[model samples]
Target: MEQRSVGDIEGPWIEPEFDSNLIRRCRENWAVSIGQVANGVLATFIRQRVGLSIVVPEAKCRIEARYDDDSEMYDGELAAALADLS
Candidate 1:
């Protein structure tokens, strides 16, 4: 399996597709709820996973969540985690 570092998500969760307008609009909404879900929902998901860890450093606004990309609702959960970071 391929593993991506948590640091990479610190910036933007680049939309898989080529569009940006919808992504930007959706991200705005996600940014608002990140705090509520990231700490609770996202953390739980990461914790349950085998090789994944979600770390929120006090110094930097970076959230690292490593796990199976094929899991259920994986992208949504990850987006929540990334939003929660900062």
Candidate 2:
């Protein structure tokens, strides 16, 4: 899995008027990772089996799985263990 920080993805284009609290919330609550699976079926299986909140983009061979931080992004060990299971 390749992980990226929110700032890396969003860049510096955010409007100046954007709420600081909202930006902080996003930084605190979200994590982004990119990975490729064999196909849609395998991707779906992983999503269901892992039980982590994820979004799998449609693709023939490569897919991006976006994992939502339900554990407040602090449970890396748990996430790693579950990922190994899947």
Candidate 3:
């Protein structure tokens, strides 16, 4: 089997082809949730068969709030949890 890093793939889910517009819109706004049900199964397979470790980094806001549109930001809890896991 070919070795793969976690970053080697796109986001941890697959969507229907027709949902491209929705996917694009979510990516544009950064409101997409991480992972999916299939991702969990895939991760289990990778762990058992490939013995690879996954590292999920912290998500932070890149753009500052220009108005009322971009104020919501990551509080670093996810990042800190990942760090602690490592």
Tell me the spans in candidate 1 whose CA falls farther than 4 Å from its real position.
1-9, 18-34, 38-40, 44-86
- Which regions of candidate 3 fall more than 4 Å away from where they truly are? 1-74
Error at 74, model 1, angstroms: 15
For candidate 3, lDDT tens digit of each residue in 1-28?
2234333444443445676543443333
TM-score: the better of candidates 1 and 3: 1
* Model 2, span 1-86: residue lDDT tens: 42433334444334455576544444333343333222332333333342133322222113134433343224343334345553
Task: Give all candidates' CA lDDT scores.
Answer: 0.37, 0.35, 0.31
Question: Which of candidates 2 and 3 is the stronger one according to lDDT?
Answer: 2
Clashes of 3: 0
Query: Against the true structure, whose lDDT is highest?
Result: 1
Quote model 1's TM-score.
Answer: 0.22
Candidate 1 Cα deviation (angstroms), residue 27: 6.1
Per candidate, the number of residue pairs that clash is 0, 0, 0
What tens digits encode model 1's per-residue C-alpha lDDT throughout 23-52? 444344333333333333334334333123
After the best TM-score superposition of candidate 1, give how far the Cα of residue 38 lies from its true spot, in angstroms: 5.9
Show the lowest summed lDDT stretch of 10 residues, model 2: 55-64
